[model samples]
Target chain A: MRSNSLTADLQPINKNIRKRFVLSRLHSLAGIVPLGIFMVEHLLTNSTALLGREKYNEQIHLIQSIPFLPLLEIFLVAIPLIFHAGYGIYLSMISKSNTQTYKYERNRLFFFQRVTGITTLVFIIYHVWSFRLAPVFYGTEINFDLVNSHLENVFVFSFYVIGVVGAVFHFSNGIRTGLITWGVTKGPASQRIAQRICLLFFAVFGVLGVTSLFAFI
Target chain B: MSAEKVIRLKVKRKDQMDSESYWEEFAIPYRPNMNVISALMEIQRNPVNAEGTKVRSVAWEYNCLEEVCGACSMRINGKVRQACSTLVEKLEQPIQLEPMETFPVEKDLVVDRQRMFDALQKIKGWIPIDGTYAMGSGPLISSREQQEAYKFSTCMTCGCCLDACPNVNSGSPFIGPQALAQTKYFNMHPTGKLTKNERLEVVIGDEGISNCGNSQNCVEVCPKDIPLTTALAELNHEANRYALWSWLKK
Candidate 1:
C-alpha cells in the first residue's frame, strides 16, 4: 500500500529524470551566461547616451557593423532568452507561493523573482518588437533621434521605466539566488554577502539604466 | 494575577482525511512552565469545548516528549515547530494550532508523513554496511569532518522544513529538503561515499535537487538548526559536477 501510494504520487515526476536535471541546470546556466551578459552589454551600450548622442549612435553603429551581428544576436542573445523565459514561465506556473504564511525574506524574494521574471519577459517582447524587429522590417534607422522620439511620450517613458527596473531586478536577484542554486555560496553568511553584492549591482545598474533613459529624453 | 487565569486555544480540527475542517476552542487553566504538549494533554483530559460540552478527545501523535522524536510538529501560532518545545507563556493569547498543510491530514493534527519516509527510501538515506558478521573498525575521520557532519546528523525527520518550503506541497513532486540534506549526510560517510554517484543520480532526478527553488525557508524552520540550505547548495554543486562528468563521458 505504501509503495502503491508512493508510486502514484511520484508517477508524474518519474519520466525523463536525466533530461530534467540537465535542462534545469542549462536553464540556470543560460540565464547567468548569455542572457545576463546581454543585459549588461545592452545596458552599458545604452548608458553611452550619457556621453552624448554621437557617442551613443557611434556605439550602436559599431555594434551594427559587427560581422554577422544578426547571427550573434540570434544564437547568443535570442535563443538563450527564449529558453530562459520559456522554462522560467513553466517553473513559475509549477511553483505555489506561500509568502502569506512563511513571511521569510527569502520566501518573499522567491515570489518576487517569479513576478519580475514574467514582467521582464513581457517587457522584453514588446520592447524588442518596437525597437529591434519593427526597425528592421520597416527600414527605419535605430539612432539617437529614434529613441528620443519614442521616449517623448509619457506612457512610453513610463513603460520603459517599469520595464528597465523590472529587468534589472530580475537580473540582480537572479544572480543572488543563482549563487545558491549553483552552490557558490554555501552558508548563510556567504549568501548574505552575495545578496549585498547583488543588491549593489542592482542599485548601480538601475541608476545607470534609468539615467540613460533620461539621457534620451 | 488571578488564580482563574486560563490559556485559550483555537485548534483547527478535522475528523478524518476527507472530512471538512472546523475550529474548536478550549480554555484550560493556566499552569506554570507548561509547554504546548502539556496544554494538549490538558485538552485530552477534559475533551470539552469552550461552550462547556463534552466532545471526542483531540487525536494527535507524539512520543519522546523531548523535541528529538519530531512527531509532535505542527503549526503553533502560525509557525511550524515542535509542540514540545514551545512554551505557553511566550505565545500570544488564544494560540492557534493547525496541522501542517503540506501533508495530508490523517485526522486533526495527525498528518501522514509517509512521503518524507518514502523520500528517504528513494535516496537510500543510510550507510550500507554488512552486519551479518562482526566487521573490524570501519574508518577514522578527522574531528573537523565529524563536526560538520554532526550538524546534519541532528535532523529528526521533522516535517517543519517541508511545511516552511514554498516549493514543497502535495501537488509538487519535489522530494523536499529533508531527503536532500540526508542525502548529503549519508554521502559524507566513508562507507557511504562508495555509493555517492548512486545518490547523486537520485539527487539529479525529476523529484530531486532540481526541484528546489532555493527559497532558504527549510533552513529557517528546522528545529535542529541544521544548515539545510548549505547541504542543498553543496548537493547542487555535487549534482551539477556529476551531471557534467557523465555528459562528458557520453
Candidate 2:
C-alpha cells in the first residue's frame, strides 16, 4: 500500500491547485513584510497629525497623490491580503489528513498560528471597513486630521488601542511563525526564542494598548 | 515494611470529542504496586470520589497497557507521562492528571491526534510497493540494520516527542522530530531508498526537518527511546548531499 511511503505520495499532485495553495501562503507571508512597511508609514503619518493635524492632512494628500498608488495597493497589497489569509487557513487544514504529528512544537504552533490567523483576519476586516472602506462609502473625510480632531474621542481612541494591540500580536506571531515556515531558528534557542518572542510580543503590545487606552481615557 | 499510603488524584474527565471537560478527585486505597492507570481503573470500577459522590468515571486513552501505544500519555503530577508506568509510590500526594498540552482536547485525555498523523502522511513515512502485484519478499537487511530499523519502527506516534519539542507548537509549521526520524527510517530501507531523495526534499523544506532545534527532549520523552537526534543528524547529511547533487546536475 506504500503506507510507509511518506516521501512517495507528495510528488504527483497537479501543480495548478497546488500552486494556488502555495501562492496563498506566499500571499500571507507577503502581508508580513509590507505590514512592517505600513507600520513605518503609519507612524510617520500619525506623528505629523499629533503635531498639528494640518501637517498630517497634507502628508496624506501628498502620499496618495503618488502615481499609480491605488493600482499598486490593489495588486500588491489587497490581492495578497485575500490570498494569504485564505490560503494559510487551507494549508493548516490540509496537513491534518496526512500525518500523525506527535511532536510538541508542531501542534502548538499550528494551533496558535490558525488562531492568530483568524484573529488577524477578523481585525484586518474591521480595520479596513472602518477606516478605509467607510471613508469611501460614507462619503466622509479620509484625511489624518479628521481622525485626530473630531474622531479622536474616547471611543475612537479605545478602538485604536485595541486595534494596535491586535496588530502587534498578529505582527510578532506572524514573524515568528513566518520564520518557522521559512525554516529559521533551531533547538533550545528556537524554543527559548519562540517563548521569548511570544512573551515579548504580548508584553509590548499589552503595554502599548494599556498605555494608549489610559492616555485617552 | 511500612505500607505505602494513599495518594490523592484530581483527574480531569471527558468522554469524547465535543464533550465538556470536568474534574473529579479520588483518594484510592494505595498499594505499593499500584500504577496510575491501575489506580484509575480501580476508580473506574468503583465510580466513587473522595467526597463520596457517585459520578461518571474518568476516561483516558491507553493500549499495550504497557505504555507502548502512547495512548495513556497525560500529565502526571503536572508532567506528561504514561499512566501505566507512572508509579503511585514515586509521586507526592494529590497527583493531578491533565491532558497533554499540544493537542486539541477531544474529551478528557484523547486529543484529535490527526495532526501528527497528517505530518507522517506529508513525509509519506512509508515504502512504496508496486501495489501488491504479486511482489515477493523484496530485499535483505543485515541484523544491525534490522536492529536499528526496529528501534525507530517502535514509534507509536504517542506524541511524547512533540510534547517535548520546542519547534513544534501551534504557531509554527515545523513538522517536529518524529516524522523527520521516520523519513530516515524509510530512507534507510533498500527499497525505501527509491524515495530517499523525495523524503530528503520534504525534510529540507520549510515545515520539514530543517526546522528541528535539537533540544534533545524528544529523545528523553520517547518511551521507545528512539534516537531522534541521530536520525535528524543523518537526515541533515542526506539533505546536504541531495542539494549538492542537484546543483551538480544543474
Candidate 3:
C-alpha cells in the first residue's frame, strides 16, 4: 500500500528560503516609509501654487537650494521608489484578480490596489522624467511658469488629474494593506478601522493633489 | 392531475480525471429540509436526467452528513462551501454545482484535495510527541490561550479557502491559507513548541507565507470561520523576526 505520508511530495526548504520574505518586507517598507512620505511632501509643495506663482517658485527654489540636495533625493526618494515600483510590477503580474467571484469590499480594494500601483508607476516615470530630469539636462528652470504652461493643454491637464488620483489612491491603499502585511492590524475589527482611516487619507490627499493641478493652470 | 413540485439542479459532471467536463440537469422531487447533499443523492438514486432519459449516476463524496468532514465541499451557486451545510431552501432554482477549480476534478463534484493534505505535511502540522507510551500531564495552558487557539483549531482542511484565494492556482507555488493556519494551531501546543523553528523554516520558504497576496478572500469563504488572514499576518511577523535573527546570528 502506498504510504499516506506526503513528506516526499513536499518541496525541500532551501538555504535562501528567506530571500522572498526579505524582499517582500522590503517592498512593503519602501512603499510606506520613503515613497509615501515623499508623495505627501510633494503634493504639499505643489499646493503652494494656491498662494500664487512666487510662493510656488520660492518653495521649489528652497528645495533646490538645500545643500547636497541631489544626493538626498537620489538616496532617499529615487532609489526607494524604483525598488518599490519594480517589485510592485512583479507582484501585480503574479496576482490573479477574483473580485468578480469574491465581491467583498476588501477584495475589490485589493484588485484596485494593484491597478493603481501600475498606473502610479507609469505616471511617476513620465512625471519625473519631464519635470525633474528633463529640466536638469536642459537647464530649464522648474518654476510656476513651466508647470502652468504645461497644464494649459487640456490633454496634459487630464493626464495629470488621472495620474495624481491614481498615485494618491495607490499610496493610501498601500497603507491599508501594508498594515496587515506587517502585523500592525491583525484582527478584522482593527483592519476595518484601518480601512476607514486610509480612505480618509485618500480623500484628503486626492483633493490636495487635484486642487494643486488646478492651481497650476 | 395536480402540478408536481420539483427541485431543479444543474450539475457540472465529468467522467474521469482529465476527461471533458459537461453539464447535466436533473429534476428531483421536492423534499422538505433537503440540503445540497441530499439533492445530489436524489440524482444518484434515480440516475435520470431532466429529459427523462437514464444516464450515469452522479458522483460526489460526503461523510458525517455534517460540515465537519469537509469531504462534500463544492461550489454551490458560485460559492465555495460545504454541500452538507447548504440547504436546498436557501438556494435559487436550478442550483449550479461545480467542482472547485483550484483542485483538479476527479469526477463530478469530487476533487483531488491532495494538495491541501500535502501542504499540511509541508508545514508539519502536528505535535511531535516522543512515543505512544504515556507521557506525564503536559504543560498547562491558560484558558485564555486555549480560547485564542480554539478559533484556529476548528479548521477541517476544507479547500474553500484555497478555492477562493487568487494566489492558490495551478501555476502558483503558494501553500494556501489552510496550512498556514494549521501551523499556527499546532505551534500553540506545548509539545508543538519544540519544532516551532522547523515549521518556521517552511513558513519562510518560497511557497510559504510570502506568497499570500493579502486579498483576504480566504477569510471570507472559509467554512470554519478560521481567522486565516490574521494567521497569515501574524506568521508574516513571526517569520520576519525569525529570518532577521538567523541573519544576525550568521
Candidate 4:
C-alpha cells in the first residue's frame, strides 16, 4: 500500500513520484535543449574566423544586429544556463562522491561529472564576462582584433582551452547519462551504442572548439 | 518548586492510509532508563496529549524489543533508527519521531517495507537448492569469505540504509544498499553462483546498481554496520564484467 499521508511539520514531504520524475526529466532536457544548442551556435559563430577577419567581424555584427538581442540572451541562454547550473550544483552538493570507495568506471564517471560541472560553470562565466560583457562595459569595438587580442594573453588562451574541453566532456557525458536516466537506453547493448554516439559527439565538438580557439591566434 | 519531571515527545500521526497526518505532543512522567519504545508504551497506556486532552493511542510496531527483528525502525530525533535501541534519556528533549519516508507508512510509526523485500526477491538474495533433503557436506568456503559474508549476513533488512540513501527516495526505482549488499553475499556462496548471471542481469538494468548515486550515507546509518558502499562498489565492478560478457555472447 502506497501511503499518501506521510508528513513532516517543517517540510512538506513529497509523496508524488510524478513530481520527481518531471524535475529529473527537466534537468536532463535543459542540458540538451537550449544549453547544448547554445554551445553549438557559439562555436559555429566563432568558427567564422577561419573564413577571414571580415567574415568573423560580420558574424559578430550579425549577432549584435539581431532584434531584441538582450531579450533573446535572457530567455534563451542566460536563464537556461542559470537553471541548469543551479540545479546541477544542488545535485552535486547532495551527492557523495565514492570514487575512492568504488573504483569502478561508472563510479569514476559520476565523480567526474560533478567536477566538470563546477569547472564548466566557472568557464562559462569567465567566457561570457570576457567576450560579451567586457566589451559593452568598456565601450570597445567588437571585432576580430578584440578576439585575437584577448587570445594573445597566454593565461586567457589556456582558460579557453581548458574551458572548451570541460564543456565538451560535460555535454557529451551528460548525453550518455541522460539517455539512461530518461529510459531511452535500457539495456547494455543500447547503453554501449549510446556511449559510442556520445564519444563521437565529443570528438566532433572537440575539433570545432579547438579549431575556433586556434582561429583567434 | 515541587514538580515531577516529564518527557516530551512529538510524533507524526496518521489514522488511515489517505488521511492527512498531524503532529501530537505528549508528556509522560519521566521514568529513569526508559527507551523510546518504553515511552511509546506509556503513551499507549495513558493516551493523553500535552494539551490536557484525551487522544487515541499512538500506533507503532515492534517484535524483538532488542535491535534484532528490525520491525520497530523509525525516525528518532529525525534520524532513522530502531526505536527499541534509542534511550529517551540519551536523546535530546522533545524527541521528534517520524515514519521512514522511503517506505509507505502503514500507521503512525510502522511502514510497509515490502519494497526492500521485493528488491531482495529481484536479486534472488537467497541460495538456490534442489530440495530440503540432506545433501552431503557443502562446498568449502575460506575463513576470509566466511568472515566477509558474516558482515552482510547481519543485515536485519532494517531499511535504515534505504532511509539514509538520497538515491532511494520514493520517486526513484533504486533497489538500495540493503539488497545490493545481500546480493553480493549470496553470489559469493558456492551454490549461489549457479544463478550469478541471473542476479547480475537484474543489477545491470536501470532499477539495479546503476541507480545508486554513491551518496555513502547508507553506510553511516546501517544499524549492523554492514559495508554497504563497499559491497555496492564490488557489485558494480562485477556487473560491468557480466554486462560485457553477455554482450559478447549475444
Candidate 5:
C-alpha cells in the first residue's frame, strides 16, 4: 500500500486560515464602521449647500481645518476602505454567482453585492480623483463654486447620481450581508428584520444623497 | 448467456499523483440491473481497453455495494453520485465516470477526501459523552428533535455537496455544506449541546457558516436529499445568537 505522505504533498496549505478569518470578519466590519459613517458625514457636509454657498464653503473649510485631518483620513477612511475594497475584489473573483440555478432572493442579493462592489469601487476612485485631487493638482479654489460649477455639467450630474445610488446600495445592502455573514442575524425572521432595517437605511440615505445632489445644483 | 451484451464505459484515469489524467474507454460484458460499480468490476476482471489493447485494471474505491457507505461516489455521466446505486441500464450509453473535483485525485477514480474529514474535525462533528462508565441511560431526546436531526444524520460524508458547491474550490476556505449540516446535526443533540460553544467558534470563523454564498447547489446535488440549505440557515441563526452572547459575556 502506498504511504499517504505522497498525498499530503499534493494538498495546498491553508496557511492563512486564522488570518483570513480575522480579515474576512474585518472586511464586513470595515464597511459599516468608518466607511459607512463617512458616507453619511460626507453627504451631510455637502448638504450644507442648502444653507447657501457661504455656509457650504464654511462647512468644507471646517472639515479641512480639523486638527490632524490627514492622519484621521488615513487611519479611519483610507486604510479601511482600501482593505475592504481589496478583499472584496478577491472574494468576487472566487465567488461563482449562481442566481440562475438557485434563483432565490438572497442569492440574487448576494450577486448584486458583488456587482455593486465593482461599480462602487470605480465611482469612489473617480470621485476622490476629481473632487479631491483635481483641486490640489490644478490649485483651484476648494469652495462651493468649484463644486457647483462641476455639477452644472449634465454628465457630471449624472455620474454623481449613479455614484450616489451605487454607494448607497452597497452600504445599505452591505450592512445586511455583513450582519448575516458575521453570524449576527441568523434565521429568516431576523434576516427579514435586518433586510427591513437595511431598506430603511437605503431609503434614508437615498433621500439624503439626492437632496445633497440638489444642493450642488 | 445470449451473446453477452457489452457496456461502454469511459473512465478518467490518472496513473499517479501529479500526473496528467487521460480518459480510457472499456467495453465490458453488460449484466442486467448492474450498477456502475458492477461495470467497473468487469473492467477490473478483463483489464482490456475498448481499443483491444491490454492495460492495467482501473482503480476505484467502494466497500458497501449499497449507497449507505458513500465510498462509491463518483461523477456518473457528468453528475456526482454514488456508483453503487447508479444503475448502468438507466444511464446513457458510453457512461462517463470521473472523480469528485473538490478533493485531490489520488489516482484513477480515487481522490483524497482529507479536506472533508478536516472540515468535520474543525466543526467537532460528534456528541461529547461524559464518560464510558455505566450511565444507564441518557436524557430523553424529543421525537421532534430526533426527526429533525435524523435528516442530518444520514449525511455519509460524501463529497457530493462539496463537489457541487462553487465556494469549496482550492482557493477558498469555505467549509462547504456537508460539514455545516453536520455541525447543525451535532449541535441539536442534548449531549452535543455541551460542546456547542466550541463548535460555534469554528462555525462563525473564516471557514465557518458565513462563507455560504447562498447558491443552493449543495441542496440540489445531495444524494440523501438532505435539506442542507435549511440546515445552514438555522445554524447560521444559532451561530449569530451564540456569538452575540459570547461578546456580551466578555
Candidate 6:
C-alpha cells in the first residue's frame, strides 16, 4: 500500500527517482525539525506559567499521560537527534565553506548559533539523561515538580538558562530563514518582516526564560 | 578628480591549500577602462611585484571573464563581488584581492567551491527532462514566471551569496542561501512544480532553509540581486501547510 501510494506520486520514470533524490533532502533537514517542533510545543506548554506554576504543572502532567510515551520520545525525539547531531558534526568537520565571511551584529549571532547548536547537543543528552532517563533507571518518580526543583539549584538553573536561551535563538533564526526559504518574505519588504519577527521571537523567549530562571534561583 | 590615477593591486598569494599565505603588492600599469580582472591579467603578463622583485605568477580561478562564470569572484575593498565588473577607478587605493571565505582556500585567491556544487547535487538542483528526447515543446511558462525564473537563472554559483551568508560554514549542514534560492527557483517552474512538494521537503529539513539567520546579507551581496529571503519566507508557510495537510490526510 505504501509503495502504491508513493508510485502514484509519479510513474517509474527517471524523473521520479530524481524527485525522490530531491525529497531525500528532508532526511537531513528532518534532523532539525522534530526537535524544533517539540520546542514549540514545549514553549507553549511552559508558557502556562504566565498564569501560575499550577497551570504549567497541569499541562505538563496532561502531556505525560499521552499513550506510548516512552516509545514516542525514543523514536520521535532520540532518532531525529541522532541524525541532526551526527550529520551536523560530520558536515562541519569536512566542510570547505565557512559562512563567517561577514562580521555584522547579525552575523555574530549566526556564529553563536552554530557554536550553541553544537554545544546544545551535549546539553540535550545530559538533559534527557537527568530528566527523562535518570528517574526510570533509578526507579524514582519524576514529574513537573522535579523540573522546578532542578531549577532551584543555582548551577542547574544556570544551565537551563543558557540552554533554553541558546535554543530560542537558534529556533527563531529558523523561522526567519524559513520565511526566506519558503518565499513568504522577499525583497526589502520581507527583510523588515524578518527583522521584526526575529526580534519579537527572541524577546519573548528571552523574557519568559529569564523570568523562569529567576523564579527558580 | 584625477583620471589617470593608477589602481594598485595588493594580491594575497599562496602556493597551495597547505602553503602559508602572504601578501604581495603589484601596482600594475593601469588604464582608463580597467576591471580588477584586467588589473590581475596585467600582473600575469609580467610576474613582478610593486617592489620590482621577480616572483612566481599569482594563481587564481577564472573561466569566463564575464560575471556569468562566477569563477573570478573575490573581495575588492573588503566586499564580495565579481572582479570582472569592479571598475578600478572607483575603487579605493590599493585594491585588495582576497578569496571568498564561503569555500576552502585552495591557494591565493582560489578556494574549493565543491561543497556548493555538492549541495546542488544533494538537492537534485535540476529538473528532469529525459522522458522523451523527441518530446514536443516543453510546458509553457508565463512572462511573470519567466521574470522570476530569470532571477534564479542568473545565479553564477560564484559562492558570493554563500560567502555573505552567516549560517554557511564548515560546521553547519545548513546549505546556505544560494542553494535555498535555487530550490525555490526550480520549484517555481510549471514543469518543475511537479517536484515542488519534494523540493520543499528538502528545504524545510535541518541543514536546509531553517539554518539561515535571515540577516538578508545574501540579497545585499548578490551581484544579480536575487530576492533570496523572500523565497525562504514563502517556504516556511509551505512547510507549515504541508505538515498540517499531510497529517490531516493521514
Model 3 stretches astray by more than 4 angstroms: A1-14, B131-135
TM-score of chain B of each: 0.96, 0.88, 0.96, 0.96, 0.94, 0.90
Give lDDT tens digits, candidate 5, residues B30-105.
7789999889998888899999999999999999887777888888887789999989999898999999867899
Model 5 clashing residue pairs (backbone): A186-B237
lDDT of 6 by residue, A99-211 (tens): 45455655555456567777678778888888778988997665556777787888887888888887787677756554444445656665667768788988897778667
Go through the candidates in order and give each one's DockQ. 0.54, 0.05, 0.61, 0.06, 0.18, 0.17
TM-score of chain B of 2: 0.88
True contacts kept of each: 0.68, 0.05, 0.64, 0.02, 0.27, 0.33
- Model 5 spans > 4 angstroms off: A1-20, A32-77, A90-116, A139-176, A182-217, B1-9, B26-35, B38-50, B76-79, B85-95, B130-132, B172-175, B204-216, B233-250
Error of 3 at A67 (Å): 3.1
Model 5 chain B: weakest 10-residue lDDT segment is B128-137
Task: Looking at model 2 chain B, report the run of 10 residues with the lowest lDDT sum.
Answer: B208-217
Q: Count the backbone clashes (under 3 Å) in each candidate.
A: 0, 44, 0, 0, 1, 27
The order of the candidates by lDDT, greatest first, is 1, 3, 5, 4, 6, 2
Pairs in clash, predicted candidate 4: none
Weakest 10 consecutive residues of candidate 1 chain B by summed lDDT:
B122-131
Which DockQ-derived CAPRI band holds candidate 2?
incorrect
Candidate 6 ranges with C-alpha deviation above 4 Å: A1-34, A44-68, A91-99, A104-112, A139-149, A179-195, B1-8, B14-22, B27-38, B41-47, B56-71, B77-79, B87-94, B99-146, B149-218, B228-250
The candidate 4 chain B region of ten consecutive residues with least summed lDDT is: B206-215
Cα lDDT tens digits for candidate 4, A104-123: 56556667788999999999
lDDT of every predicted structure (CA atoms)? 0.89, 0.68, 0.88, 0.80, 0.81, 0.71
Model 2 DockQ vs. reference:
0.05
Chain B TM-score, model 5, reads 0.94
DockQ value of candidate 6: 0.17
Q: Please list the residue runs of candidate 4 whose C-alpha ends up more than 4 Å from where it truly belongs after superposition.
A: A1-217, B131-135
Query: Residue by residue across A1-217, what tens digits does model 2's lDDT show?
Result: 3365334356442334234324534554576766545653654455564445567678878887989987877876677777777765755554431112334553454455556667667767877887678888988887754454434577666656666666666566566655544435433456457757776866765565455334322
- The sequence of per-residue lDDT tens digits that candidate 4 reaches over residues B1-250 is 7799999999999898788889999999998999999999999999999998999899999999989899989988778899999999999989999998678887788789998877777777778665679777779999999998999999999899888676677456677889888889999999998878777766665567766664457776788888776677677667656765666776
Q: What share of the true interface contacts does candidate 3 keep?
A: 0.64
